[model samples]
Target: MNKKPDYLAHAVLLLGMLLFIFPIWVTFAGATQSAGAINRGDISLLPNLSHLGIFVRAFSFGSGLTGSAPVWHMLLVSFGMAMTIAVGKIVISALSAFAIAFFRFPFRMAAFWLIFITLMLPIVVRIIPTYSVMSDLHLINTFPGLTLPLIASATATLLFRQIYLAVPDELVEAAKLDGAGPMRFFWDVLLPVSRANVAALFVIEFVYGWNQYLWPLLITTKGNMDTVVFGIVQMITGDQLIPWNLVMATTILALLPPVIVVVAMQRWFVAGLTEVDK
Candidate 1:
């Protein structure tokens, strides 16, 4: 059975969809033209097969990013950074959550609150001190430098903690009776049970890491270490004459990985986010 849609709701939805898609459509259209055409403010919604070579150029050779490394290399770096951040966040958050949820210790609440408090202080706020620490450690221009500072995630820990809290005490008792140590219980029981949440959080953290700009721009002195996200910014180095075609190509490339992750895992991602199991 179908019901008639509210006109107001339909209008609002259409408007929102247009707002979301207009920029992307414009980018796709611009990506198929010459830099000169785009620079001249002449763009149309027609595909230019001749301009397809621009994508090849952007991939095989670097564009306006002033980097000798190709866009593919930047993609690889972004993928590595994103994966490291996602996995690191999950591992640390899971362990921290397990400790807080299952163990009774001195200052446990204090430690949890301290970590939670950090959620208020974004990376921007601590950039100076964080950069100093990274510099002192000689991590600048390094992969670790780009990622390690960003891995401390209180939100993931909180999410996992909430999930763990919802688990039944009977499960723990059953595992205890089966001679399962804390590590054994966590590995064999909790981890398996939390797979959906892990996948969900992976999607979130991966996108966050991939989209990072300011930190990567600051830490990576070498052009080779730049991420695809920053690579796009470098394409428009100045307002004098922007390379719109190449910029659009790079933008599309940057959008693909996260988009693929979301599309491929939309089922599990949505489920995990909306329905945490006990």
Candidate 2:
């Protein structure tokens, strides 16, 4: 006989979905309402359509830092930095994973474990040393300083390594037989076969870079180099009393890029994680 589906599980999942979505719904509702309405917290169920001016004011408000701190410029800088980190991380970590996964060499296992050990240490533990190195290199308050320390993560390398391990040995052997060196094999075989994983990593890393506020705020003292998160923070904490409606609107805008990437590339992202599991 066909078994009945789990009604309890379905109910739990439906409840969880509503719980998670409720805050986002509230934020959207608040975005449409006045700051006064949000403060009252009474209009939680429906958006106050009477005050659509909040979004307009948020989008149109010029950055009080300087006339140049436009919303578009903040978006561009944030996207650019995130792209750089994503690309650099994927390339470097993929190469490292390829070398460790396929090669036979002295201390290869040791080196691999060393990379894995880095995963245990939080970035907070390394910040002082990393900052010292960046300062000595005169990269402080610069793009390189912002990115180089965080461009490659051990977790990314580990993820790629697991994905590479799923590739058939015969293909790598065939490449070797053809006298294709490591770089050539990686470029031609591993990368193409693992493109889904790469895409997944890029999306994940891009979101990480985009949401990174503490590190950038700590490193970048200059106003022009500030990222979108930094800009948003400045908006909230600046001399002007933070317009709550505007703050929520800007927060929503800042959130869209990563949300779009995840929604658009969700299939590949899931495929990559599943591949790693195999």
Candidate 3:
């Protein structure tokens, strides 16, 4: 028989859930509160529904709080850059993972190890060098510069590799017997089998791209190309005082895309992780 749920484990999980959720709750409440209330640190458990105008003002970029560029344009630029990175990363990482996991080649293990070692290296350590390279390539302040370096993540490659490894060897052999070439086998057999994993990877990659701040900040110095995060920083740092209500509202808006993706692709996400175990 299966063991009963442990009371301590349940309690710990409940505590963790609250810890994670409390900040979201606070942010929502803060978005609804008046500027005075936020600045005064007036804590409220529930949203101040009477102050719903704050969200509307924030969404419309009509909030007099920040005289900087419009929030809508910043949002669009950020989304564009994020989508570019996400799509590029998914395509490149998936193909590379498929090749490394399925094919035999010279220095295969060494190559895999070299890529995987990036997982252990801190991103900050490479920022200066990456920036210098981008400058040399005349990519500074360009969208491509912001998106290119992160086109491959060690984590995504590792996840896809594990998923590929779970594929049945017979499927590969059958494809070979049917006169399917390596690329065809990869496209037809392996890819179809790993659809859930691919969807999961796309969602994960999208979130990483969307939330990327430091690199985008470094690469995009122009106001026109500024990402939402960098734009928010600019909003706060400008001559006008920080409007916590508007800030919280914009933050919630920024979070919506990733949240929607996770909610929509939840089944694939869970399945992707579960399949790796088998």
Instruction: Name the lDDT of candidate 3.
Output: 0.81
Candidate 1 residue lDDT tens string, 1-278: 99887999999999999999888888888999988888788988776877777777667646444444678999999999999999999999999999999999999999999999998986788999999999999999999999998887899999889988888999999999999999999999988888899999999999999999999988987888988888777767754577678879888878889999999999889889777643
Worst window of 10 by summed lDDT in candidate 3:
60-69
Window of ten residues with lowest summed lDDT in model 1: 60-69
Each model's TM-score, in the order given? 0.93, 0.89, 0.88
lDDT of 2 by residue, 1-278 (tens): 99999999999999999999887777778788777766676556687788666666665554477643655567777888898999999989998998899888899999999999998898899888888899999998898888888897798898888878888889888988999998898899888888888988989999999988878877878776778788888887767656677777777777788899899999999988787676
Off by over 4 Å in 2: 40-44, 49-57, 60-68
lDDT of each: 0.88, 0.82, 0.81
Q: Which regions of candidate 3 deviate over 4 angstroms?
A: 1-7, 62-68
lDDT of 3 by residue, 1-278 (tens): 99998999999999999999999889988999877788899968799899877776776562343244567776787778778877787788778888899889999989899989999999999999999999999999887898889887878788778878877888888888999998898888877888877777777778888888899878876766766777777666766667888988887787787798889999998887777666
Q: Which ten residues in a row have the lowest lDDT in candidate 2?
A: 59-68
Most accurate candidate by lDDT:
1
Query: Which residue ranges in model 1 land beyond 4 Å of their true spot?
Result: 63-67, 238-241, 276-278
RMSD of 1: 2.1
